[model samples]
Target: MLVIPAIDLKDGMVVRLYKGEMNSAKVYGEPFEFARAFENYGAKWIHIVDLNGAFAGIPKNIEQIKKIRESCNLKIELGGGIRDEDTIKQYLSLGIDRLILGSIALKNPTFVIEMAKKYPIAVGIDAKNGNVSIDGWANTDSTSAISLASKFKGSKIETIICTDINKDGTGNGINLDFTKQIAQASEIPTIASGGFRSDDELEMMLSDKYISGVIVGKAFYEGWINLRDIFVKYQA
Candidate 1:
């Protein structure tokens, strides 16, 4: 599995939000610096989320994203506030390796199907106790994560980013059972996100054939985990 580093941008600064809460964000550093550091640490892919845009319903960190794109060779997978074809086209043109659709994937799945036909797209399913949450985790939907993921079984989605909000930013370790269930339900290569605590947890995730990758945020940022060490250990 790929040990992808997450760079969550809020107001042009790199940060990590507690449980997807906008007001609970902790600023890290500038985007360019973090991107460069991640590249130096052997990151082949970088996961970025525009926290501001996720809540505002439109991208708010285009300039910072563009700067990061120009600053490194790492493949970037961006999400948050990307709700239209025009925005999808614009980001891909700006050199994003992949675009992740969260809210639209739940609210307008047909649009996601159409976009998946044209661009490299993935669906971001944030869940709280198996139920899907949207609008930056501000609201909960009646659908379960597994049910939603199963709906994309025949679609062109490249991957599924499954995040457990309860475990996010808590350093509590990933919810392996929950992640495995989604992977099994969708038959999609899943990238596990949230509550990545240690190397052992990462090893377990990599061992699972269903898990394709992992997105590490607070663990990497707070020195709880070392990117270079993880790269050497997993060699994914």
Candidate 2:
């Protein structure tokens, strides 16, 4: 399994929001340092979310994101405020290895499907109470997480990142069962995100063949998960 480190940028600073709430953002300084550190630890990919972009539907933390891309060797998978072809092309030109469509994917799967065939793309399914959430997770819809994931069955999409929004930044634990449904439904390698807590949680996810990766956020920022140790054990 891949241990992907996350850097969530809110107004150009690294921050983690509790349960996806903007008001609960905990600043952790500039993003450049963290991206470099994660790269040094042997991470193959870095997960970056422009918190401001997600809400505004336009890339807001461009310079901060560019700083990370230029400083680190890590392949970047960026999501947020990327709804159109122009924004997607802009980030790709800035060296983003992958683009994850979240809100737009929920609202228009056809557009997402078309984009997937043309670019290195992934689908982010942020679930709240087992239903897919959108608009930076400010709204919940009737579509089930499994149902939404199944929509990408034969697409060229790279992967599905299933995040349990309720558990994000809580350090409670990852919602493995919730992720499993998405994995099976999508029939694609899925990455689990949000609420990552312990080595035990990693062990459980590692045992699952369908879970290709796990996004570590608050757990790593809080200083418990050793990136080098995790990389050696899992990705070595």
List the global CA lDDT of all models: 0.91, 0.93
Weakest lDDT window of 10 consecutive positions for candidate 1: 227-236
TM-scores, all candidates, are 0.98, 0.98
TM-score, candidate 1, is 0.98
Q: Estimate the TM-score for candidate 2.
A: 0.98
Worst 10 residues of 2 by lDDT: 224-233
**Model 2 spans > 4 angstroms off:** none
Candidate 1: list runs displaced more than 4 Å: none
Clashing pairs in 1: none
lDDT for model 2, please.
0.93
